[model samples]
Target: MSESYAGKINRKLLKKRRIINAAAGREPADLVLKNATYVNVFSNELCHADIAVAEGLIVGMGSYSGMREVDMSGKIVLPGFLDAHIHLESALVSPREFVKAVLPHGTTTVVTDPHEIANVMGTDGIEYMLQATEGLPVDVQFMLPSCVPATPLDESGAVLDYRAIDSFYDHPRVLGLAEMMNFVGIIAGDDQPVEKIVAAQAHHKKIDGHAPDLVGNDLNAYVAAGVYSDHECHDLADAIAKLERGQFIMIRDGTAARNLEALVPLLCAKYADRCMFCTDDKHPSDLLEKGHIDYIIKKAIALGADPIVAVKVACHNAARYFLLNNRGAIAPGYLADFVVIDNFQDFTIEQVYKRGDLLVDHGVVRDFPAPEVEPYLAERARNTFHVETLTAEHFSEHRPRGIIGMVNGEITTVDAGYSDRIDVEYDVLKIAVVERHKNTRHIGIGFLQGYGLKSGAVATSVSHDSHNIIVVGTNEADMAAAANRVVELGGGIVVWDGGAPKAEVPLSIAGIMSDEPLITVNEKLEAAKDAAYALGVNPGIDPFMTLSFMALPVIPTLRITTRGVFDVTQQTYV
Candidate 1:
């Protein structure tokens, strides 16, 4: 027999023998949780039982004695929640810091798309994230970024081709390809995307989808290209259509885009099996205030979803879909990853254990210190922020044809038609996207409303997709100062007023993530928000987040880039 086949048989037999021994009282379990009402996601039932674990796998789940045991009289045990899709870099904290913020909330696994970091540092960035997450309490699985720049219309620091991505498929934590944001290219049968899809499929890896508002034959064409999942559905109709077409819909509840409420109606019995939950992009403030996947579960239950169904969506669905064969349940041979809660209604987590080890106790993360980053990885942060010398004259708009209107919550923008002259009095402020990568000296200037910046200016190197320098302000000099300040700090978010920086958050890791503790980063971010509000930016809007999305051309209506104003609906620059 072949070596692979022999190994498979030996593993199956070994598991069966161990399970039998543990159940028959012939072997003592490593750990046991007695008298717990654990959820059975497969049967959709809550059964009172004792769980026996050994070597990080559940060997038995019945009456059993163990070397260590805990009495759970009334608590509910649940499979650890999984975030189907997320961008860890968007939290503005390094992977170590990001896990520290979310693990206490019972998110054991997160499928992260590192395209944000990939755009800035390429494969090295992806490797840094992977290395940082090693041995952490949270299982951070990676999806190789499918589109580095997101599209050719924008310039990015690094470019990842199919050959480059093929090398990462063999990594243990790399699950599959990230979202294919280049939907236009996929539909046009572009050789580059097609080959990437083919390469992933050959390895039997999953391909995530990113078609926002795409429907009809175009949707069919994109699906036919082997994209298995999508998290970009903004409405019920879109969700329904994609579900009917055999696409797994990931209901997203993120920092800027809150679609869970709008799409929760689709989480009913008929379609619950085809749905999962993800936070495609989230900020630190939201993660801290509202719990991670726990927040989604509570909200879904409050909105009248069956508590078990919501649990399935948060846990089982993602694991099965992602082919994480050893997890997603509390059963024999499954990884001993679970959360202890007071009840299903409030879902108040009391403790969390991963791989049979206590990671969080009573809502506090246990002692699992983050590893020191390799010196070579630290060196990658140098020389990233590269913007040409910018001045107030570069931001001045004369006879502008159109303005990029900001929507409060969504990434998409609206193209409010042309204006004859500058109008800062009406809250119409100047917006500019400067090409930071390669120092192209390219600047796209336009007018924006709804920013509510009465004075001063805000800038960030965390621009989505392209990772360029984006600044918005009422005063040209402040805007110029804010933009250049971000460059001088290597890369970060900055707020400038009175011709000086009022507050700044330095993201030294590829201009997107800070290596500092999450608490420190959160403090800096809060300070920046305070400064933004002090400068008369809208109180309801997250000024930094809203400013970041302004340069993403992939989203609808209107967006600005170093090239010029882009009309997403028209699919061309105007």
Candidate 2:
């Protein structure tokens, strides 16, 4: 009992006729904003006009009458902000909770890569997020995880090949392949990476990149393989090099890697068009305390970036890059998504509208239906941990081939060479990555410097790219206890000391996110951080957030995996 193709076409034609009539002033619009000064993204300037809405589309931008009107005489109107790249699971909250935190800040759309959960639950995790984000006020789109296991060095919960994810390309909300973290493999012409790239290219999907310091011929090869964009640019030089070689730049300003200040110079007339704003991985505390994309805009303006250009990068540029052409502008035939603000200086968001419906007013989101979670998916996600009980003997590894030295404010690390003795007095600690997915009892033991952990232990199942259970501690007993506690909670971060848990944040959703409210998660995360700091953890770096990245082998100089400590620069086991 469905309409025929011709019938559907006729129905859409009728709706288009109504929209044209409304724009031509022959019919009353559903809503109108009177005397508005809106940002004209095409013209790159602010223009005064009245915006008319009909059927949730901006049908006109001149004088028009509507059934309902809101006066906007002195306020500034902008297209709703879009996050070019983000990991929603990094917020440590479910899609519903994450929306509540970002919607008030005027982030009406986000293009996310669910690789974090996909590493733990595979395609089922991707399906869970797709269902969890449907029908929310904030439009959530997806890019399929390009590197689920990240690389061959890391052993994740699941291995995603091209055949494993080919059906996802047909999804309406799926944009393309996510970040291609295996740049080395691609440059070397590896078959696995090449096959995935060729498959996505065949579907005409955008392929995102993650080449950090790649330059010269290697960079050319990466772009030649048809990668469209990159969010891993850490400096202006790196971004400019990629931009000149035909790749869109995603200026990342996130929790562990704050690259906005370093790349602020790229927000100019010459380069701003190719740039977009993204919080690649924002933590719970940062999302609640600091704003989302709105925070990036404010900081860009503060760093002497032109207000108008910054707004364009935050809104229109991302929409254009992601090919969501319908909702990024205020012109006719575009969706009526907007962010009304007091001014650009404070960048204070006053009201937000999504498809002509007022979703947020005066820093508060209106009531809407939360996405329905299927009972089976919810049960499957709640029980992702599959590790056997652990003892202190399992963590007793004295010899470490190499040590990972943490960068103060960045996720990138250093090859701190090797040391046989555990020097607790010199801020050296023991770190281990336990393979919790298959429970093969495979543990990679290594030493860590600059973590500043004097005593006790901390463990989290939120390790990046792989989502393995990674723990760091002063001794084997505390390390084993902390890691076991994480398994006991199904999946979570635990801070243990004196043979007891100090604080814990349970992430029952695929070992990465919680279904609780944002504020509650933030409270628990902050308490856990405090407990970590009390145990002599570094105050400069986020304890759990930074620890989570130690297992990501694609990042930089050195990293850890379930196999062993690997030197990323040399591409070999240390």
* RMSD to true structure for each model, in Å: 3.0, 1.6
* CA-lDDT, candidates in order: 0.87, 0.91
Model 1: lDDT equals: 0.87
Score every model by TM-score.
0.94, 0.97
- For residues 1-574, write the lDDT of model 1, one tens digit per residue: 5569889999989977776787666998888999978989889989888999887888878898898999888999998999999999888888878888888888999999989988988888888788888877899998999998788778888889999878899999998999998998999999889889999999999999999889999999999999999998989999999999999999999876778888999888889999999998878888889979999999999998989889889999999999998888888888899899999777889999998888899877876778666888778765687777788888766766568887776566787877645577887887888988788789888778888888888999999888899988877888899999998888999999887899999988888888788878889999999988988888867888878888888778889888778898898877
**Top-TM-score structure, candidate number:** 2
Off by over 4 Å in 2: 1-7
* Angstrom error at residue 343, model 2: 1.2
**lDDT of residue 495 for candidate 1:** 92
Which residue pairs of candidate 2 clash? none
Model 2 worst lDDT run, 10 consecutive residues? 392-401
